[model samples]
Target: MSYVLNDPAAFADESTDGFVAAHRSLVRRVPGGVARTTAVPEGHVAVVIGGGSGHYPAFGGLVGAGLADAAVLGNVFASPSAQQIYTVAKAVATEAGVLLSYGNYAGDVLNFDQAEQRLIAEGIPTRTVRVTDDIYSASSDERQKRRGIAGDLAVFRAAAWAAEQGLDLDAVAAVAARANERTRSMGVAFSGCTLPGATEPLFTVPEGQMAVGMGIHGEPGIGVQPLPTAKQLGELFVEALLAELPDGVTSVDGARLAVILNGLGSVKAEELFVIYATVSTELERAGATIVDPEVGEYATSFEMAGVSLTLLWLDDELESAWTAPAYAPAYRKGAVATGDTELLTDDDAAAETETIAAAATPEAAEAGRTARDVIVAIRDMIDREADELGRLDSIAGDGDHGIGMKRGTVAAARAAEAAADAGAGAGTVLALAGDAWADKAGGTSGALWGLALRAAGDVIGDTEAPSAHTVAEAVEAARAGIQNFGKAVVGDKTLVDSLVPFSDGLTARANEGAALAVAWAGAADDATRAAAATADLLPRMGRARPHMEKSLGTPDPGAISLALAMHAAASVLNHTTAQKEES
Candidate 1:
C-alpha cells in the first residue's frame, strides 16, 4: 500500500533524489548512490555497502564517518549493477584498499563479485564480506546459503568501525565475517507488501493468521499460523533465534549480547516497543546480558507488516567496536568530529569535458548513426511494455524489472545519441550506451546488459563497419559473456535461454552467406520461440527461485525482455539497409 507515487516506474529514482536532497549534510549524490559529504580519509579502508532501494537506511542511510563510505542502490528488491558498484568504489577509494559488503542474495553476489574483479583488474585492491545471518533461510550445515536480514546492521557497523580504527582491508573483512557468524535473525509477517501500482500485495495472509520465517523481498513465510500476543511473539523470536546458536556458544549463561527488534515498514514504534519489552525480559531469563539494545527500523521491505529480531553475541573486541560512535542519516550513536563537508556535482565535471571530441572513420560514423537508431528503438519498446514486464516479474519475482529495463534503455538511448552527435564510432557509441544502461538500471538485468553490450562493442572495432561475420561473432560473444558472468544455464528460466538460441541462429545463418539483416531477423525469431518455451521451465536462479510454482505458467520476464529487444533490433537493422538501398 504505497500511497504516494507519480509514475510507479519512477518511484525508486525520485525517492533516491529526495533522500539526498533532505540529507545534504550527511550524504551527497554520487553516480551509483550517496557518499558522505565529509571527505573520505586516505590511509583507511573504505567500507562500501549496497542492495535494492526499498531497504533505505540499511544501505544509504548508513553512509557516514563511522559507517559506509558509499552505498550503491538498485531498483526495489534488486541488486545494484556491477558498473554502479565499481563506479562508487572508485569514487571513494583512497590509498587503502576498499571493502564491498552486502546481504547474501543471488543478484548481489553476481554483481558485487564482478565489481570486485573489475576493481582488482584496475589495480585498486578490494575485498568483500557478505552478510549471512538469517537463521531460517538454511540449515547450519548450509550456513553460507542463508540470507541476511536485520542482522546486516551488526556486521556492517562492526566492519565500518574496524575500518575507522585504521584496520587493513583483510582485518576489516575478518571483523565483519566474525560479526556475521555470531549474529542471527528471524522475521514474521502479519501481511504481504504491495508494490506502488499493484492492486494487491505480493502475498496475503488470512485474517488473524501470520506468516513465519519470511524474507524481506515480498516473499511469503515458510509457515503460517494464528497471530499470537506480544509476549508470545517475543517468545517465538527468542526460541527461533536461539535454537541455532551459531556454533560458538553451548549455553547463554553470562554471554553478552546486542539485541535489535526491527519493525519492517508498516509496524508502529509503540507496537515494537511493546514487543521489545517482553523480548528483553526473555533474554534476561536466558541469562544473556543485553548491551546496547536497539529497537527500531533498520532493514525493511516496502510497507510490509512484519517484525524481525536480531541478536549479536559479543566478545570483548566486539563490545568495544559495537559501542564506538556512529553518525549516519538513519542510525546514530555518540557525536562525531566534523570535517570538510564539500560536495561534488556535475558542475565540477562540465569544465573538464569542454575540450573533448568524438573520433571515428567515415564508414564507422555511419554505423554509429545506425546504432543510435537501434538504441532509440530499444528504449521506445521498453517504455511501451514497462508495465507489462513489471507485472510478469511480480508473478514470481519482485515487480521492478519493467521499470529497471525502461530506465536502463532510456539512458542508453540518450548516451548513444550524444555519442553519435559527437562523431563517435559504432563501438564507442555502444560502449557509452552500455555504461549508461548499467548506471541507470542498477540490477541483475542491468549488469547482464552491460556485459552483453560491451562484449559486442569489443568485436565492432572503430576503424570500419562490421561485416556479417563480425556481427555474428559479436552476438556469440554477447551470449557467452552473459552466460559466464551471470552463471545461469539455459534451463535456469533466465535471459540466457533466449540469448543462447539467438546467438546460435545468427551464427548459423551468417555462415551460410545470408545478409546481416536477414540473419538477425531469423535469430530474433529463434529468441522469441525460446523465450515462450521458458514458461514450462522452473526457475533455478535469482529471486524467482523461491516462488517457482507461481512462475510455471508465465514466461520469465528476463527471457521475454531479451527476445523483445532482439526483435526490435532486427527491425532497426532491416530499416537501415532499406534506407541505404533507397538513397
Candidate 2:
C-alpha cells in the first residue's frame, strides 16, 4: 500500500515535483520526464531511457552523468506517449544522435519506436534497444518476447556509458543490445502491490504460497507453489539464469557475470543480503566469477513485496562498460569527472507550452464544434464508467484503463475546445485532440487511439466539411492505422476487434446514401456488438497476454473503450442531424 498524500491520479506528477526539488543539482524537469541538470557536451549521443512511473531509480532516478541523459515517464505501469519521448530526446539530443532504451513491453516498444521515427524525420539520428531479459516471461527461444525486469539496469548503464564515451548512436545502441541479450531476470512475489487510493492489491497470492515468474506490473505469477526458504529461492534464481545462457555461451564455467539482487519495492536490504549470500555461493559453485554484485532496489514496482535477480554475462567490452562510474540520483558508483555546466535550477527548467493552429474554412470550423461536442461526450461517459472499466481491466491487466481513458478523453476534450476556439477546422481539432489524448494518457490504448484519431483526421481534411462517404473513409483509415501500428489482427483482442466491424458497417451504410449521422449510429451499434463479442476472446497481445485465461470472460478494455467513444461520437452526430432537420 502506498502511503502518499494527494490525489492518486496526480501522484506521479507531484512526486516528480519533489524529486526535482530535492535533486536540482543533478536533475532538472523536462516536458516528459527528467533530464540531467548538467550540460550535455556537443556531439554526445544522448541516451534517453524510460517506461512507466512506478519503476523509480529506473527512469527518472537514472538520469545523470553516467546513465540516461533524459527519461520519459508515463502513468503508473504504462508506457509514455510518443510525443513525450520525442520531446525528451530532442531536448537532450546532440550532433551524434540519440539512443532510446527501455523494457520490452508492448506499449513501450510501440511508443519508443514511434518516437525514434519522428526524431529521424526531424534529421536527428535515433536508435533503440529494448531490454528483454526476464527469463520467466517467455521460453528460451523466444528471448525477444521476454519482459524486462531488474535487468533494465544492465542495458541502460552500458548504453549510457557508451554514449558518455562519445560513441555514435549505432555503436551505443549495439552496446545496449549486447547487454540486454546477456541479461536475464526472474522473481517471486509473496504478496501484491496496491496502487495509490486503491483498496485492493493488484493481485494476491494465497497464504503460505508464492507466485513464481510474476511481472513488475502486479501481474500474477505464471506458477504458484508453497513458499520456499531463502536458500531454495536463491537456488531457483541461479538455476533459471544458468539454464538459459545467451548464444555462444554454452556453459557458465569461468564466465564473469554482473549480478543484481533487486528488491521489487518493500523487501528490506537485510533480507536481500541473506538471499544474495546464498546466490553468491551458488554462482561460484557453478564456476562463474561474479563482478560487482549489486543488491538494492533498482527497478521496483510500487510497494511490491518481492524481489528479482538479474544476471548479465560480461565479456571484455561489457566488463569495462559495467564498471564505469555513474552519477545518477539513485544508482551512483565511483566518482565521475566533473565538467558539467552550472546546474539547472528547478525554476529555470520549466518547459514551454505552446499551441499552433492551421488555417480553416468557416464550414469546416462549424464541423469542429461538433467534433468538440463529441469529445466532451466521451469525457462525460468515461468519467461515469471509469471504475467499471478499471475493474474489468484488473482481471488480467493493470486496473488503470478506466482512469487512463478518463485522462485521455478529458485531455482530448480540452485540446479540441482549444483548437475550435482558435478557429481551427474539424480535422485540425481532431488531430490536436488525438495528440493530447496520447500525451496525457500514455499507454498502449492511448497510442492506438492517437493513431486512429490522427488517421481519421487526415482523411477528413481541414479545407472542407466531411460528407458521409468521407466520414466512412476516415473510419476505414483509422482502422488501417490501428491495424498497422498495433500489428493486431481481428483475433488479437485489441481495439482492432471492434474497429474493423465499425469501419465495415459505416462503409456499408454510407454506400447506401445514408446520412453521416445515420451511418455512424449503425456503425456504433456494430462496434458495440463486436466489443461485447470480445468477452470470449483470449488476448494475444499487450499486458493481458500472460493472463489470457483470467480475461476469458471479459471484453478487452481497449476494444470496449473505443466502442464507447465511437458510440458517444455517433450520438453527437445524431443530435446535430436532428437540429438541422428541426431548423
Instruction: Give the clashing residue pairs of candidate 2, or none.
Output: none
Q: Would you list the C-alpha lDDT of every candidate in the order shown?
A: 0.86, 0.87
lDDT, model 2: 0.87
Off by over 4 Å in 2: 340-359
For model 1, how does the per-residue alpha-carbon lDDT over 1-583 read when each residue is reduced to its tens digit?
8899998767777898999888887887777677777656778899999998888677899998778988988877778888778878887887788999899887788789989999999888899999888877767887887888899899989989999999988899999899999999999999989877778787888999998877888877767899999999999999888787766788888889999899999999999999998999988999999999999999988899999999999988788878888999999998877755556552221211222146557899888888888889999999899889988887777777887898899889988999889887778888788877876786788888977887888888677898889989987888888888788999999999999999999999999999999999999999999999999999988777756777898999999999999989999999999998999
* Model 1 stretches astray by more than 4 angstroms: 5-10, 196-200, 335-360, 581-583
Q: How close is candidate 1 to the true structure, as a TM-score?
A: 0.91
What's model 1's overall lDDT?
0.86
